[model samples]
Target: MNIMKRFLKYTALTVMILIIWVAAIFISMDKGWWHTPFTQDKMPNEFIASVQEELQNEFVGTMAIALFKGGKLAEESFYSNDKPADRNTVFQVASLSKFVSAIGVMKLVEDGKLNLDAPVSRYLTRWRLPHSDFDNTKVTVRRLLSHTAGLTDGLGYAGFKNPKDVQSLEASLNKAIDADPGSDGRILIGVEPGSEWRYSGGGFTVLQLMVEEVSGQSFDSYMQSEIFEPLQMHSSFYQWDENFQDRLCDFYETDGSKAAQRYYTAQAASALYTSLADLEKLFHLFDEDNVNQKPVSPEFQKLMWQVEAETLGTPIYGLGTFLYTELENGGFVIGHDGKNNPPINTAFRYNPVAKDGIIMLTTGSTNFATRIASDWVFLQTGKVDALLFTMQQGKMIQIMAIGSFFILILVASIAFVRRTGK
Candidate 1:
């Protein structure tokens, strides 16, 4: 009987302690002391609901949507598989890394560490930009960043998958540019720098080389420490190491079939893993007057929003962010989309005017996803001013479960005491 009393007393104390701990957690969460990620249930806006519904039925893969109004999260929702997509569900962002790389390079420009007009050959000690009989010195950092360096995208891909075991940037450039694949692999200057608007992944890669040379740091470390960490984008990082493979969302072919994993090492122009929630924080930079507790001076932020391409006849390209100036009714937004391996299409767009935007990471890289994204944009635009409200529905469920366990334990303790006492 004495043993039974001691057992009940211990059990009661344990249960009470657990209850207090759970209550404290809830209280902290309610007070925003904990990083309680917001889901669609907490979304207050109609725009989020519209996009969520569209993506759920049309988009075949997992996705997360977050909408911002005046730099604040107006609506947020996530619909995925049995696995929930949160702020940490890292997905391969592919070419979107180019945008990030561009930012790093621009920071160099801002610091007066690199010259936009200076020849890239000035920094490179080994092989220079492919001259092919033309002066390689003509290729400048500005030209490379704008993809106007007369380089082809094919050669960029070839160099990335170059057969030689070249560890240094100089050795990589010395590699032969394959001409058989197509003229895209050809690196000779086809036109004057800054004369034409071409999407050259090769040019971006060269920019990566320039960044490495100027900053005196590897591409991965520089961006992680300089840009991502400062922005509080904890989920953003380079795609390296087999350990990260576990957190990776599975990639699919354009047809929604699973794709074989293909690894590449050139990180500057491509290869980044991030989550939709993290992307939203990145876009928030535009809406805010400060980032990382530092004042985002009007002049500096405008440089990011500045139209770098007057010759292209539009504001489609900015410093690091793409100028999405063609939204139907909504004002202009600065954003970019990424496609790396086939079937892994990802995109994030933000509108400073409406202060609303959407971010999606899809495994299947199909035009279908793009179409779906366009439709979602239109749907969200209709309900422009949306509202969201949420109560801790899960808390009630947790409370019930905890209460039931406490009751069961109490009854068992009472019965044990009676049996032993009698």
Candidate 2:
């Protein structure tokens, strides 16, 4: 009898703890713990409701949407994770790392420790730009930011399988520079600098080395001190830790895992974990004054915003961000898309004029997902897509809802039976 009683007691305790845990997640998600003061959530309640309903039907495993106006986060909501993803849900934001890393480099520029026009060799003493007939000296910092440094995005770093897969920064850079000319390892200034636009992930890796050399701190430490911490992006991180592992959402390709289980040594170019709430603040910077006194003057910021590349009298790439001065429909966009490692798709599309933007993070990547994103972009331009407000319950939602339903059933059944009837 005592054993039976103990069993019931322990079981009740376990269930109660789980209920508390789930409720905490729900509350934190509904009302975020970390955020900036808001004017209004950019998206209206009706709009959020409509989208939230539709998100349950989407293909992505986990996702969140944040809307901001003139630098204040207006509305934010997350939908359906295999694990309930609240505001703290973290997704590996692939090349988005470049966007953040560039901020670090710009901080160095603000400190007068680096120059945008200076050759990378000036700071990255460990490994210089590889020899090509192209003048390495022209491979300046500005060119790297704009991806116009005549460099090709070589076979970028392999996703590390484990700690063994990681390599020292010096060794990795040196290998790239020292590889045989025709070998797959070599990354050189393949074209004349200032010739054309080429998206080079490798270029950001170079910037990573440059930042480390100039700051005299590990790349992670430098970013923490300069960008992440001051900005209060508390959960944003480059390397894996227990907290990250607990909050990490799963990623999916069409049929398999698109995200690598291992980490990358190229921390600057890729490898960051963050959330929509945190990212909303990062995107806010494009629209608001740097409240943190980010050292750079307003004029210098204007320089960063200036499009470095041009065609037919139109501007293209801004510093680390892209500049869409004019769209085909006569609208404008000035943000970047990061389709880093597979299955993890993230984006920040800010409308400078409206001082509003979409901060999207998703752990699902597929051809259909791309189409959905396009529809979303068009929707921003006032094109109507039927996606918002429709509920297409994903697996996670069905399971969580079903379990909650069972719990409700148990409670109701217990409450209805009188002691005499029992």
Candidate 3:
């Protein structure tokens, strides 16, 4: 009996040591001091499997990932045991739509139809922003695209199932611009526009109005002609088309409940349905533009990569994308992340120097997509940024550590009691 107790005691001690070691590792990883080294050569499939396992264990509903090599689509995979999610499944890439919106705006600018520094009032003839004490003239297209337009957030109208249920740009502005006439929350121009950075989903909606007015075409039609159709990005559409309905991925909420058939109407800000394979076509434009193919102007493309604005405690905003500083040569990783509903998380990051990138889309709310993108960025650059992983679960990890320690203590106590009784 004593020998048996000794064995358990040793086992319990080993368990306790392991718990502490794991706790230390997690803490170190959170603090950006540790990482699971990954190979850059071919994208370690084992690491991806591990990430997928971790995501599944955490109850993430679905995942799709694609990697680009030499600025071309190289590898792609899908993960979801609960439902049908595959390589071509279209996901509502929320804020990622903003990048496309910016691209459309830039295309017009390249043709001299729109001016960046000009006041948005030049084109938004259908509707106008409400009057405020702040100078509205400073609210230029450049500020709006860069998120420094100083406009307040609009009423979020993203989850309505019927595309028609989504309000029109004129309606969104009328409601968001004032109280009683529109929404509960009115968009406020609190500060001088262009003087500082502020994120306004409403600003993009406002741009939708400008796109229509200036081009004499519907916002969706303009994008189709100028960007998507020209680039052969057949799978991307700004609104819900019957053709994409069958290809849409199921969205899951944070509680792991499947989202009902919902469609977002914020066409400029969040209402884009696309697959990773389709997005590669859009990314290829950036690559060709980098080499001066003039799909868009070289000057405008260069500006897309330049740092435009940044807020305190957040990544730098470059045009419609966030600037990632993780890559080694100190170049830049350009892309955007999107969340349509709580459970829908997507990340797309691109490297300019090597023209390589990775796209991640998931129906999990954990922001696991960022971690996956960060891992690739790290492997490419040999430098890490933003912890790359482990930033979102500090409390859960701590609880796990403490719980494991207590379990170890309970086992040791049981062994001690057994030995004494014998």
Best by lDDT: 3
TM accuracy, model 1? 0.68
Cα-lDDT of candidate 1: 0.59
Candidate 3: give the clashing pairs: 175-182
> Which model scores highest in TM-score?
3
Clashes of 1: 9
For model 2, the superposed segments whose C-alpha errors exceed 4 Å read 1-58, 155-158, 174-185, 256-260, 289-297, 310-314, 325-332, 366-422
All candidates' TM-scores? Answer: 0.68, 0.71, 0.77
lDDT by candidate, in order shown: 0.59, 0.65, 0.73
User: For model 3, how does the per-residue alpha-carbon lDDT over 216-296 read when each residue is reduced to its tens digit?
Assistant: 988888888888887777888886788877887877777878876565545888778888777867777777533423357
Candidate 3 colliding pairs, count? 1
lDDT of 2 by residue, 105-193 (tens): 88888779999999888887787777789889899999998888998745345456577657776666555432223436546678899
Q: After superposition, how far is residue 381 of candidate 3 from its true place, in Å?
A: 2.9
Q: What lDDT, from 0 to 1, does candidate 2 have?
A: 0.65
Ranking by TM-score: 3, 2, 1
